[model samples]
Target: MTSAAAVASPATVRPSRGLAVFWIVAGLFGVATSFLLYLEYVGQLTGADPIVSCSFSPIVTCGPNLLSPGGNLLGFSNSIIGVVLFWGPVYAGVSSLAAPGGMRRWYWRVYSLFIAGAFLFVHFLAYRSVFEYGSLCPWCMTVWLATIPLFWFTVSWTLREGVWGTGAGTRRVGAAVYSWALLLTVLDYAVIAIAAQLRLDVIGSLF
Candidate 1:
């Protein structure tokens, strides 16, 4: 006979509904924006005079960025990479929601690493848009918008759920970060907005 206390506990935790929903929405949004940009790039390459939907004005256009060597860093439109990468969060969200035990810790850690890379890459593109290229791509900004929150929330959730570790200090830090995730996301947006305003006078350019 085995004692009740001898049974092993389950290793997996249920995914947060809120975080899962965010992942779905943000991933879909990223995919849409990235696809749009990819289509525009394809049109450009094919020598078609397709009107770019995101090209609102001279200051706010995707033409230069799409045509620039920076956009083809990997010898293809960066948006093509975006189209592929954004699907990861969507799959994670869908599978985690459908699974009884949700996702494993290793899964989240790997996902977080990719998102961290995206966060860094997004900031680099923002820097180029502000200083190097001197034009704003609306679709690129949309991708940035989607990625920023996804990164913050995914990281916060991983921390709060013990994906990073199961220590008291780690949990405490994760909880603290989770509580401030939204405000931090807003602050990130503000940083980009302020930079654009300073370098490009985005508001003045609009008028």
Candidate 2:
């Protein structure tokens, strides 16, 4: 007998119902954020001031932040790209849940890559917003926050299922690195927010 017949391919694993729901929620958030950005863009083009539908807060104004040079990083609106990329994962996630055979391994692999790319893109934008732009867009920040957990959960799930690599040690190291980076990013944001608050308080006291 040929050695080729000695072994069977491993069975494919499907994501749990919980994971399916997580993906759906993440996709929806991405869609909502993109829509808000589009609205801001329309307001800008029409020379109309962007209106905040939410409660009045410094963090809620999309206009001042969007019109800044850093917002249009690629010389055009980032929302256009966000709309296109956000829907792909949404469709794939919903289809994965409904399909009897579940999503193929390659499909998950591709989806992970796409989401990772998006996570990185958003990370860059957030960094620019904090350091260079010095202004925040509430919708964009919401999307950014949503993306952090979305990417982390997806990558963790994929890694656990052995979709990313065959070596367990390599996967562990990668996961550790990702976790540390996420923690550091969160801490950085916290520090920035605290410092900003302190500075504002001090200025108010002096006036």
Candidate 3:
């Protein structure tokens, strides 16, 4: 019984640590991204272009991006959403470390689902900003980039916890789903980067 318990303990403890690390890294990046967005938001409110003030210059302008229709998703600024979504995960990750037994499995599962929903929403907004708005908010893109790791790590952690299931069939299907999501995200970013580059080139050529 002692040996059996020891084996099971490793499985639970090791994965939890790994998941905690994932959330910590994601939270740190999210916090940094939020700070940048806050600066830009402050600049917009005060009638100054923060990106230009920061020396990003002609190629990147937070002002235009913030003013775009996509920036006000559902009538609220995107940074506001980032603040709510990111701070929760950051708090959760930190609290887990300090508390006894850390966070529970169900807590992680529910939190992961919440973050997943946010990720989907943000991805949609990102697509609109890139394809329809025709501008990239550097701060917004940073949030998007940070969100990827948050989503990926959460999903990975959930899988390792066997929250979905432990059967071979379940594992196979889960792996496939994760792989497809990752592939789609990569393809989407690649297309957006290529399109943005082309747009910039065209504008440059005209001048």
Candidate 4:
């Protein structure tokens, strides 16, 4: 017979419930889009004519855009990469949600590194699609949109909460991120969107 107080309590981290919720929503959205992209990619590989429903225009076709050389740079569809890559955040988010207790210091650090890689790779692929492929996969763009916030806030929270390490510089930067994360994220997207307009003139070309 075990006493009621004998069982150990579950551990919890210090990050806010809001942060966990943010991780969950953002992670799930990215994963869902990535999964959709993967399905589209698979359809193309299998020679399916009706690959996806959103390919009614030249600049927004999922099939041709994904079948381009850039999509297979790794000898496979980049969406596959996205399917795998977005899971990092998904898992982290789930963990945070289930157990709001903060994760280990090193966990945040490692996540930051992984997201950094993902952030860079996404831009690389985006550039290839924009300039070389002359099109954009809507699903890919969704992943890009989700990833920006994921990376921004992940880094921001890690620094602000001193999850990785404690230091004056880290705290100072973290404070800045906490204050300006949303504005910076919006600005970052705005700059890229503006640049894309300059080169692609998406609206101008559409009309």
Candidate 5:
């Protein structure tokens, strides 16, 4: 029978510095973008002008989305959620860098779950913004931009590290997917871009 120490020290892949750096950059970008949106929301509450820096036109602005019912779907500004949760990636990256021995499988599993939820939520917001509001929110788009990669990379890394499974086949599949994480992220961006263009004529509005 395997000893307790052996069972606890199962061989597994560790997160690399590159992945850590990506998380840090993406997290910071998300935090900054969300904070800007939150400040805009605060401005609106103070009876300030609706037309803010990110507002370019009626079809391509954040003002309506910010004031709309969907903006406060959870009884407060969605940007506040973004500002608060974006730090998770930053903290994970810092921890990985500080302790290169790597985190436990359970920790990564929970983190991946959090990122998955964020991925779905951002896309849902995107759909509502395009179909319901018929507007393109620049700050919200930035949040989506940051989240897309964060989701893909975190999933990929967790897979490669055996957080999902430790079997040889599982790790192989994880390695394959990890190598394509960037392409997957780009494809995701393309899907959102296509949807936005079809519904809102985003390109035409910009020109």
Candidate 6:
């Protein structure tokens, strides 16, 4: 009979440097962008024009978005929210890296859910930015882009590892998703861009 250690598969292993790097980049970008928005919010209150490099055009403006009511949904800047939430992935990534044995499956499962929520939130913000306001915050877009792969990888990895008590069938499905997650991420960006291009003349408005 096969021993327990011999039966164990490499697919059941935890996250690697690739997944960690994805989170690190996502968290760092989110923090940076949110901080910039905070600066923009400060400038708004001060009646000073924020000198942001991403302030490219009327359609690609961060100032107006920061000054809008949406910027302060809970009596505070959403950038504050970004600052707080964005640190999660960074902590997860760093901790996973630091631990010699790597993080637990349940921990990764929870982290996956956290990133999934972030993915949804970012999409909502994207909708508001393009359709509602007809403006795009370049920094916010960066967070959105980072979140795509971060969410995809976490959840897919969780499922592949059977963290949710998944069996072989589910593991196979998860493995497939993990394999194609990057391609799906690129397509996601494409679909969002197409939607934006259809709704707003993003290119035309730029020039």
Please provide, for model 3 over 1-207, each residue's C-alpha lDDT reduced to its tens digit, 9 standing for 90 to 100: 001001133223223444455567777788778777867777887876565353253545566667666776658677776776687777766765566444555666788798889788777876676566666667777787778756765665456445555667665654554546556567666765677667654246324
Superposed model 1: Cα runs more than 4 Å off: 1-10, 47-52
**RMSD, candidate 3, Å:** 5.4
What candidate 4 gets wrong by more than 4 Å, as runs, is 1-13, 47-52
TM-score of 3: 0.73
Clashes of each: 0, 0, 0, 3, 0, 0
Off by over 4 Å in 3: 1-14, 49-59, 99-102, 173-191, 198-207
lDDT of 5 by residue, 8-77 (tens): 3564335777788778889999999999999888877786764348877667888888888888989999
In model 1, pairs of residues that clash are none
lDDT of 6 by residue, 1-207 (tens): 011111124333446766776677778988888887787778768877776766788888677677677666788888898888889999987886676566566576778888889888878878887778888877677767778878777777777767776599887777788888888899889988988888987898889
For candidate 4, write residues 1-207 as lDDT tens digits.
Answer: 011111112221345656666776777788778778888787777866544564646776677668787777788887777767777776876775565345666776888888877777778877877777777677888888988877777777777666656687896797777667778779877876776677677666556
> What TM-score against the true fold does each predicted structure earn?
0.90, 0.74, 0.73, 0.84, 0.90, 0.87
Model 2: pairs clashing at backbone N, Cα or C within 3 Å: none
Error of 4 at 49 (Å): 5.2
Q: Which ranges in model 6 have alpha carbons more than 4 Å from their true place?
A: 1-13
Q: How close is candidate 2 to the true structure, as a TM-score?
A: 0.74
Model 2: CA > 4 A from native? 1-11, 49-60, 170-207
**Which candidate order results from sorting by lDDT in descending order?**
5, 1, 6, 4, 2, 3
Cα error of candidate 6 at position 39, Å: 1.1
Measured over all alpha carbons after superposition, the RMSD of each candidate to the real structure, in angstroms, is: 5.7, 7.1, 5.4, 6.6, 5.1, 4.6
The full ranking of all candidates by TM-score, starting with the best, is 1, 5, 6, 4, 2, 3
Model 1, span 19-100: residue lDDT tens: 6767888999999899988988877788666555777777788888899988888988999999999998898888767876
Q: Estimate candidate 6's RMSD in Å.
A: 4.6
